[model samples]
Target: MTGWTTANILSTLFGAALFPFMIAVAWGKMVEVFGAAGGWVAGFWIVGVSWLLNHGLGLHHQAGDVWIDMAMAAFVGLFVQSTLAGGKPGKAVPALISGVLGGLLGGLILSIMA
Candidate 1:
């Protein structure tokens, strides 16, 4: 309310409307990259993990916080994709390791940003 302005309001409204479209595009791309189950898992996992990290770590929420969250998400997505791709038990270790690495990288980037 304090910073409300016509331009801000309009932009917010536009962004809200565009958000779903963006999600759909992302979803499609994920599905293409990872196939159906992996894609869905990655998409949902990103949201869940991001929420947990943001709140659990007590990280300050800011406009660019999503960049780090998304980076982690991509790491998770790739892990899921590779795991599902092989459909092998042994792949789990590699997937987890890569995901953890991705998460570490994302955190590092976030720290640098801060």
Candidate 2:
């Protein structure tokens, strides 16, 4: 079995816990800069740009390492929260769900290919 280091485990836990807050901040910024619809567009744009940079430029070499994916997810989560939840207190739920799911999906795909 693969042994997990304490730092790795701790970082993972911290990242998971902090994810929602990151999404919230991103959502707030997107909403502030652009309207609801624009936020959605920006979210998609972030994903697309990240993909192009990672694949087109051959930047990502590690499997299952999804820092870019997480950034995309954060943008998307913000978009969802701004559009559907309107930055309400409950918006964090959807934001977290979307961001985590999106990041996981991207990481899984990358891992499979790698």
Candidate 3:
């Protein structure tokens, strides 16, 4: 233990919580814009973003990391694809694509950070 302090623990908690918060915020916005279809699009966007954050942070093999990654991946792969395929292109499609791209970018960011 490297003398973990309150700041360190709180930082960790906040960092971890941010992922879900982002998903909720983005997803809700998407839903508002595109309804169920947008929700689907937002789902993928969340995954891509989450993946990037998780991998970028490169958190050690913690249970929380596992949960976040799994949740994000599932939404991106399943919901995003389905949503885009089901409906015409709305704002959601771009958002979803951006999310995945962002995740990739996040990987690069992590390389620099780590």
- Top model by TM-score, which number? 3
Better of 2 and 3 by lDDT: 3
Off by over 4 Å in 3: 1-11, 60-114
Superposed by TM-score, candidate 2 places the C-alpha of residue 57 at a distance from the truth, in angstroms, of 15
- After superposing candidate 2, which stretches have Cα over 4 Å from the reference? 41-114
Query: Over the stretch 1-114, how does candidate 1's per-residue lDDT look in tens digits?
Result: 554666655544443333343344466677788899867785686455444544444332334425433344344445455456675657477867886898799779978996
Model 1's alpha-carbon lDDT is 0.54
Clashing pairs in 3: 44-76
lDDT of each: 0.54, 0.56, 0.62
Task: Estimate the TM-score for candidate 1.
Answer: 0.29
Model 1 spans with C-alpha error above 4 angstroms: 1-4, 41-114
**Residue-by-residue lDDT tens digits, candidate 2, 31-112:** 7788897679756764455555444444333335434344444455555666675566564688678868987897799789
Which candidate model has the greater lDDT, 1 or 2?
2
- By summed lDDT, the worst window of 10 consecutive residues in model 2 runs over 59-68
Best-matching candidate per lDDT: 3
